[model samples]
Target: MTATAATEHVASWYAATANPAPERPALTGEIDCDVCVVGAGFTGISSALHLAEQGLSVVVLEAARVGFGASGRNGGQIVNGYSRDMDVIEAKYGARTARALGDMAFEGNRIIRRRIEQYGIACDLRDGNLFAACNARQLKGLRDHKALWERYGNRELELLEGEALRREVNSARYLGGLVDHSGGHLHPLNLVLGEAAAVESLGGRIFEQSPVTEVSHGEPVRLRTPQGVVRAARVVMAGNAYLQGVLPALEDRSMPCGTQIITTEPLGEELARELIPNDKAVEDCNYLLDYYRLTADNRLLYGGGVNYGGDDPADIEAVVRPKMLRTFPRLAGVGVDHAWSGTFLMTLNRLPQFGVINGNVYYAQGYSGHGVTCTHLAGRLIAEVMHGQGERFDAFAGIPHLPFPGGRLLRVPLSALGAWYYATRDRLGI
Candidate 1:
């Protein structure tokens, strides 16, 4: 997408109410740093912060302004765990690796809180999340997942049944749910922007409007942009879905998927409390999941709409408003103040992709819909590996990610075909 097209694509509620930051200069001349990061989303910024804090000279190049991608406009749920369930990981990688992965997933949430406190970021952090089951089968699945979590000795989950679930969420559509105190919500844009500030404070350079156009790997990696280039010993590709053709090897490993969200005009405290008395982020177990949370200002922020094709549908409100009303009919007539969409990178296995290409060029993406927390953990892991401490990073890198069938040109169609199957399964409760 062109720069203008990218700007037009971002009119999210988070952007509209984001905390202002100083404008940084665009890259105008060639520069060099110990580490050069491409794309200024959460992964890039967080990686830059961690590297800079360790006293490495780092420079970040953003295609657009900071917090201009999915990092800024996500559902804001700091969900604990990978996009793939723990059992899936255990089945694939055995119990030991699965437990390690599960512990890392929980650490992802803790890392975000630690950064918020360490940087004094004011992103309206909350401390609750609900995984609501749409049917009895899903409820049973939730119970099984809870049991596994307890077996692992990480039992921070509270099981809510029937009326108990209704008391917390005011939704009769769900049977029972799991409330996780460790998982919560936050102002996503604020968190990204704050991290960017923290990166700069740690003596890192961030250049906005500096889209990397070309990359060459040799003794020293080189990244070329429209106006400038960066040469460094190491390069980190943190572009995620907006990466375009920066790294062709990653193209087939992940596909860009669009997800939409809508926010209503602020509901008063009383009404907001009535909607979600516990102020928890709520999400259903459907293939096309419905996740919603109340903003710090009391607006109902509802998000769900996964499209394999990258196009952003014209009628954002039309597509997601009904989903919102299905859970909160009391807000049926409430005006939708904002509607926007973001592109998330999803892998075939629904797990994050972390590996080094050609040894020195590191890339991390494919968070699926579980990035709000995982990206932070990814940054830390990437930093640790860069500093010669690769234990945890190697564990994640060990998880293999297959290239999307049909390659780049046909992956979307292939994914769409697969999505249909899942959607049908969700509808049939099978």
Candidate 2:
């Protein structure tokens, strides 16, 4: 199976404001390395940086550009923990596994901060994230969530209610909220581009516009791109939803879901703070959630609404603008400057799928909306495994995942049905 080149970044507000990255040449000849990683998104770049730091020769191939996928076009919130949360992991994978996974949950944010400081990556980093609850039940859930996370060793949290909550968000929509001081947001594309530069500084190679077309099993696994081939002792597939059909097994274990984001014209400093008083990123508590934050230029970037079949909405603003208006009615007439969509891989259980294939082939996907931070943690784990340290990698790999049911013929419809059920539950204030 061959993966196709995306050719360019999606038309997003991020692209317009991104720090200029030098155009890199495509891979045109065969090369050998200690490790060959496919996909130059967060996971692949993070892994490449770590592997290079470990003194391993590394090369990364991207079907498009680095951060071209979800890594570049996401809500930007540094959400704490996995998408499934620690309680779910504890129930499904046992306490031991959950503890290990929990320990690493907040490390991604640390890694981001460390790298930003060490390499002087100017990505407009922020300091907090807010989880708002629409109803009383949801408020109680936030209270419970704070307690749960506290028990899991995440103590940098505060619960707010009534006026406190309203003051936090400057909106009457939420009855209460849970603020994680450890959680925040940043410029997604610039973060990845900076990491790519850091990887190059460490002698790691990255090939843009090079899509893998084949993977053959052998002592040195062989990977083929259109104009180049890579023969490495090990191969890692970190392409996520953008991997296309190159690897059937990974495709089977995950489904691509498209989500949209719309950025309004810059609100200026005063208006921006008037919308979100403290400038914290926020995501509401709902099955179909809406997440938003103020960009460095003061634009309100709001995103949500999922398409299970992975089809981009004909008009991104038509799908997302209403959600943004509903959240901040004061911005009803605000002009949207850019709109775009990106695909993310989701598993049945909403946990990331990590494991080995063909012995030396390692792949991790299905972050299920938690890709931002989890990808960094995953990269470190993969690099560690390559260096004869597999404890952390084994913990995540041991988790089980259910493949999409009914295959391609009915998996999407089935998933949509499930989504409808949960969305209804959310509407009813459950």
Candidate 3:
């Protein structure tokens, strides 16, 4: 996974239907810039885009291609807010911190839409997402969720149950659901690629297949790759899960987890519409949840299950197909066109960690499983910090992060056991 060895995009539906993009050259020599960004996924690209728009000299270095990590290989749902709810934040971090985060919870979605319109990035932009409930407890939770979001000034939500919920999901698996009118889904890879193009258009430089092997944090930060070096006044570590060896401090507090997805063959317009009447992205209420949405080509893209140590399942399809069948028994014999897995960084608290090291090197990671929107927000917050506005960023940085209790050797099994307990609770509906 290091930048020394070149890697291509994963063999997923997103890659198969990706837009034609030019191959960016790897860094060959030392380059100087105002800022050097590590990792060209959503956070790196988004941070670069925001800074470049401000007319700063920005350089991006990626271990592989742009959006090669969780950015490209995600559920693609623009689910707003953090992995933990606002109430959870309030309980742990105080009301002021909760208010600050709540205010910016949905800003990432706005940032995305603005980029789409400003740059004309076409990634099958759609509207609306549903949070499905599997039982009465979850159904009531969704009701409270609606009220909680509304309290935070998010009124673009509606609670639905019984026949009304069926109209949205068309599945017997869910007892009820809540819809986020502002939340939605899209082609994530294309979105990041388009944003990278926009970054270049703003005069930012991005080097693909350029892994930063070593980082010397001083007055002028130095990032070493196999073939070249980047010298800059400041550095932003946005590598998330794939970012290993360079900064063990960041890696120590986070664990990489893998999630698998499978896309079925195009079911035609009629069946696709029948499957999702409104075509909104759907995620069920569970400790380890299943999320799904329809692609522009009318295929049902379904994903679920997690491997705590970022280990790929023996057969991605084998792990996900049964879940798909359970959701839609009619698709028993549906041929899967693509199956893939992507790793995302997970923290014990299920909240992102943002901080500065040595007063110049900044980093944001550990979005847990709620990264699609948060990563973009992280970029904006990082940009604000670089611009000397640290109030908002401090709110996130103020939240403390603890390392996995079992450390590297035993962290996976310990986490898996904890997950099993909650998942069992979810199954029993207690």
Candidate 4:
């Protein structure tokens, strides 16, 4: 559960191009607040902002600078829906609960748009997303997915086929795609940092470089950092993959899996338009999905491939460059400007984990790979639960999550073995 490796993995394109913000002072001496939040990522920051708006005293603790984790380093695809499909949820839960969850997913996207407008966070917000089909089987799957979504009255998506998709993407690699107008892309780091500023403006205190080393629950929870401590009426653990062993019970529900991304040098307006004609973010239908989008500066930021264990694969470009070339080989000679990696929390059911650890201590994590929009909704729901409205929160809490098989030491290997099976299925076109 050490975070030394996680800290070293923070050099990203987002970090290199981030705008300057005032340095948040580190935690010093002891303090108390109504709520103490761990991890200053999207979930924690968004929660702090909402809680502060409700006139609650809140404090946020971060191990590094603001937006230093996956919140800053993700592919920035603000996709709608949960990690698992709604139909799968309906099969497990009842149809009523599944439809409610679908509505919640749509609400999550609305919350993101509202926050961006309210805060005036200028993060290069774009308007569309394309879920492409790399093979014939995937093409059929995308069509089925479109019909399923339509069944839930979610009809903002269209299924493209034949030459229509090829005309838009100019990629013979994909047979067709599902275009979701509800989904889009943005500069994630800017969004996170801007939300942090909004939280501070609302009188919430955020401490950077203040990692929580221990926590003890009493009438008021006490969170201890290296230099200081925070005593609050309640505590929220939003650290996600970087949670480490701060909360052992929560840590067992998921494992940290590393994903890599690389951005090529600017491709100019003509080539950018040719790559993604309508300037939409694109991800192919694969167990290990390939996602990419064009930056405001015209760089093609492509991401795919995952490292199941803790190994940070060398030659990231060697692994991802060919995938990018496969889609847009026209950029074969384009030089990659920045190559980086980040860790995402993956749950056993591929669903987000939301539940109260004890009674007063609530935690949310394990959004799988569908966190950009879901995290915002999670924050709002957590805020509602704190404000004595726990209906929606309990709905998500009903979903069960089990600890990874094998003990702490063996979990990684077990996960690697499981991932290999899915990887094989994706390759065999199952």
Candidate 5:
């Protein structure tokens, strides 16, 4: 679906339970700054915060409210690393480059923990994340994943199987699981809102309801909105899949895919703990995966199901509730209190697309389904490159991403068919 009304957040459990914050005014007149960031989600806010911390003047503009896109409506699991794991990076871009990228794989998690402590952001910040396996093949992959990650100095891990795995989730769905001490889950919207407050405290500015209609790329980049124009020496296109038409070049390289989530009515503390006894964020190893976790208030926030073409399922609640039940039959009669869908960019290779456009215009997109922590990393990389510390930034930008091959008309159907094939494979446990 299109962005919700600018004045309010979309219908979501996060919106209902969100902490209070002052509403930011929309851009209404011409303004100039050292840098202008489009989209006030994680990337924009994080970029603004990073730049402002350096004492640079930064302005952020958003189509709707802060974290109104995938940033707000995600499953809230901060799974470490990229959509494509490090092994794929090594195969595609050699060991040396993969090693360099690997160093920063978990850096975003550190950035998040630091922000929570430094700013005292109350996001229900927790520790540890679980990667569950659906079958023996995926179980072996998790075993290998533990080894691969340990090689990168990430040694805080626990492998669980048989009764241990079932005890952790209290479900028979998973064959095994890998728990990463560094990864965790939290109130995603609150995290972004707190970061936005921190950004303002650091002297950065943010504008809501100020969607850019045009971007004139020149020496002093001009971003034109209906009510205002922001001119800056540098511009960042961080809108990801939600960005439409402002820059056709970046839009062509990423496809907007929809994912749905449902939050069950408060299950009392005992039931909640029983569902996830350790209370770690859990995601399975299927290609089309289901992720769920207990909220601070003890609700089961479960999310899965993807629409590759960015179309909303006719009944989002209907589409997702069954999936939740299938995973936890004990919750057969649990009433779903909230349901919502949001979009994220998908790339051909399932890797994030990071690069520059016309030299001064920077863009990052297509995180597939792995954007939570990566968006913060994207902000850091953007800040690094803007200051000429391009090594780490280039490590990602150096990787290439092809445009959606089927073009405007056929990409949706083409990608959907491919997704079906892979999802079939996942279902068959092949």
Candidate 6:
């Protein structure tokens, strides 16, 4: 099965404001390396960077530009933990697995910060994330959330409501919220682009517009692209939602979900602060939630809603603008400058799917909606296993991931039905 031809990054607010970067040439000849990574998004770039730092020859093949997928177009919130929280992991997978996973939950955030400082990458880092609750029940859940994370040794939390909560977000949509001081946001595209540069600086090779069309796994895995082929000691399949046909097994267990975002014209420093005081990223607590943050230039970058099957909505702003208006009614007439959508792989259990295929092929995907931080963590774990340390890697790989029921035909409606059920409950405040 051949993969789709590589393309350019979607035109997004991030892309418009992105730092200047050269267009890397496509792979056109055979190459050999210690490792060949498929896809140049966060996962592939992160993995390549880590391995290169270890003195291993690494070549990354990207279907599009680095950060073209979710890495460039996500909510940009550095949310810690998996899509499903630690308590869920503990309940379903037992304490040992949860402990292993929890230990590395916050490590991704650290890796990002370290790389930024060490490499002088300027991604406009911010210093906090707010989890706003729409109702009393959700607020109570935030309290429990705070406690659950604290149990896992993360104490950089503060529960606030009424005036206290208003001070942080100033929006009336939230009854209260929990602030994760350790969690924050940044320019996601720039972060991944910087990481890709870091990988190159470490003598790593990254070929853009080089999508792996075929894989022949063996002693030395062979990956075939349109114009070239890569023979590597190992292969890392890090193309999340965008990777298709090249690996049917990975696609079977995960469903690609499209998410939409719209960026409003700069609200000015004063109005931006009034909307999100203290300049922290904010995501509400709901089955289908809304996440928004102020860009460094004070533009309100807000995103939400999900479309199963990775189909971009016809009108992105139509799907997301109302939610933004509801959150900050004061910006009712604010003009939206850019609207776009991107796809992220969602697993049945909301945990990332990590494992080996044919023993020499390693892949990690299905980050659900929490790819920003988890992808960084995935890179480190993959590097660790390659270095003969598999304990942490096994902890994630050992978790079982079942394929979505009803197969391709019915999976979308089935998942939509489940989302509708929870969304109904959210509306009823149950």
Query: For model 2, which pairs clash?
Result: none
Residues 1-430, candidate 4, lDDT per residue (tens digit)? 2324243226677877777677888799999999999988898988898899999999999888788778899999989888899889999888877977877878777888999999999888998899999778999988889888888767899899878897557788888999998889999998998999999999999998788888898869998887899999999899998888788877777878888899999999998998888989999898888999999999999999877644578788888899899888888899999988787898888999999976888888898888899889988999999989998988898888888888668888887787789878877878
How does residue 46 of candidate 5 score in lDDT? 82
**Model 1 ranges off by over 4 Å:** 1-9
Lowest summed-lDDT stretch of 10 residues in model 5? 1-10
> Which model is ahead, 4 or 6, in terms of TM-score?
6
Predicted model with the maximum lDDT = 3
Candidate 1 lDDT at 277 equals 95
TM-score of each: 0.97, 0.98, 0.99, 0.96, 0.97, 0.99
Please tell me which model should have the higher TM-score, number 2 or number 5.
2
What's the CA error at residue 382 for candidate 1, in Å? 0.8
Each candidate's number of clashing pairs is: 0, 0, 0, 0, 0, 0
**Candidates ranked, most accurate by TM-score first:** 3, 6, 2, 5, 1, 4
164-235, model 2: which lDDT tens digit per residue?
876668877888899999999999999999999999999999998888888888989988888999999999
Candidates 1 and 4: which is better by lDDT?
Answer: 1
Q: Compare candidates 5 and 6 on lDDT and give the better one.
A: 6
Give me the overall lDDT of model 6: 0.91
Q: After aligning candidate 4 to the native by TM-score, how far in Å is the CA of 166 from where it should be?
A: 2.0
The TM-score between candidate 4 and the true structure equals 0.96
For model 2, give the 10-residue run with minimal summed lDDT: 1-10
Error of 5 at 352 (Å): 1.1
